[model samples]
Target: MLFRVDVAAAEPLADQIAAQVRGGILRGDLAPGERLPAARELADVLDVNLHTVLRAYAKLRDEELIELRRGRGAVIRADADAARLRLVELARQFVGEARRQGLADAEMLAIVREAQP
Candidate 1:
């Protein structure tokens, strides 16, 4: 999966890296059991600190989306559910956009209800 980060963006570089990986998983570009690039290598390619890539991998590990093993590096979990993860990511984006639009919880709920068929 291709990773890109915007230094000028408000979000941290690590979060950006994590998000791209999540997107890759969700889109089936990264498959189960597939090993991700080494953090140090990715750091050099992305021109970010090794800690940044490590932090991103750590986040994915914490979320149970990837496994970090000694010498194995980071591997996409065999049981990772892309569909569920996609739904969760979508929900987060929806909520963030709604809040940016000055929407309240009730309004967001109502909008979702209206969207349901």
Candidate 2:
């Protein structure tokens, strides 16, 4: 997976890393069982602290999106894609419900916008 970091962005480095990695998984850019670069190497590549990358990896692990193994580095979880797929399925159901309720696309989008963290 490709990673890019913006030093000037308001988000923390670890969060940025996690977000990008999650996005890659959702977009099918990262396949299950793919090994991520070592934290130290990724830190050097992104010019961030080693702990920053570790934190990101930990977050992914917590979400069951990746697995961190000794002598094996970080690897995407086999069932990781299921989460995104489920989200897509739920979205389709939600859109259908919204349509049935006579909600316009723009109205549904507005509701989604308001639900963002």
Candidate 3:
């Protein structure tokens, strides 16, 4: 697969990787069930860290755009509806996990409240 990384971009490397893969998925450049290059491979190509690739994969997985499996690596998810549902479930889990880490509902509420224009 032909992929290039822009180290000069303002966004985080993980976010940049996620945006490209997500756009490719939406534009049909990468089809459902297609296998993405392994994180290590992509990292080497991008001259970034393996953990950066993993972070990108994790973001795409959170977006329901990809499925990461042991040994099998990451693959695009085919079912759009299922992906949406999966994102919802992941959001719930993330919020729950954050709460467990001492980020209470009130603190979250305060952040949201402060974000308004």
| Highest TM-score against the true fold, candidate | 1
Off by over 4 Å in 2: 82-117
Candidate 3 wrongly placed segments (more than 4 Å): 81-117
Worst 10 residues of 3 by lDDT: 80-89
Best by lDDT: 1
**Candidate 3 per-residue lDDT over residues 15-82, each given as its tens digit:** 87876786576456788889999999989878999999999999889877789999999998886354
**lDDT score, candidate 2, position 79:** 89
lDDT of 3: 0.79
Please report, in order, the local distance difference test score of every candidate based on alpha carbons: 0.96, 0.89, 0.79
Per-residue CA lDDT of model 2 for 5-78, tens digit only, reads 99999889998999888878877888999889999999998889999999999988998899999999999999
Clashes of each: 0, 0, 0
What ranges in model 1 sit over 4 Å off?
Answer: 103-117
Cα-lDDT of candidate 1: 0.96
In the order shown, the candidates' Cα RMSDs to the true structure are: 1.8, 8.1, 7.2
The sequence of per-residue lDDT tens digits that candidate 1 reaches over residues 38-109 is 999999998999999999999999999999999999999998899999888989999999999999999999
Q: Look at candidate 3 and give me any clashing residue pairs.
A: none
Error of 2 at 19 (Å): 0.6
- Which residue pairs does candidate 1 place in steric collision? none
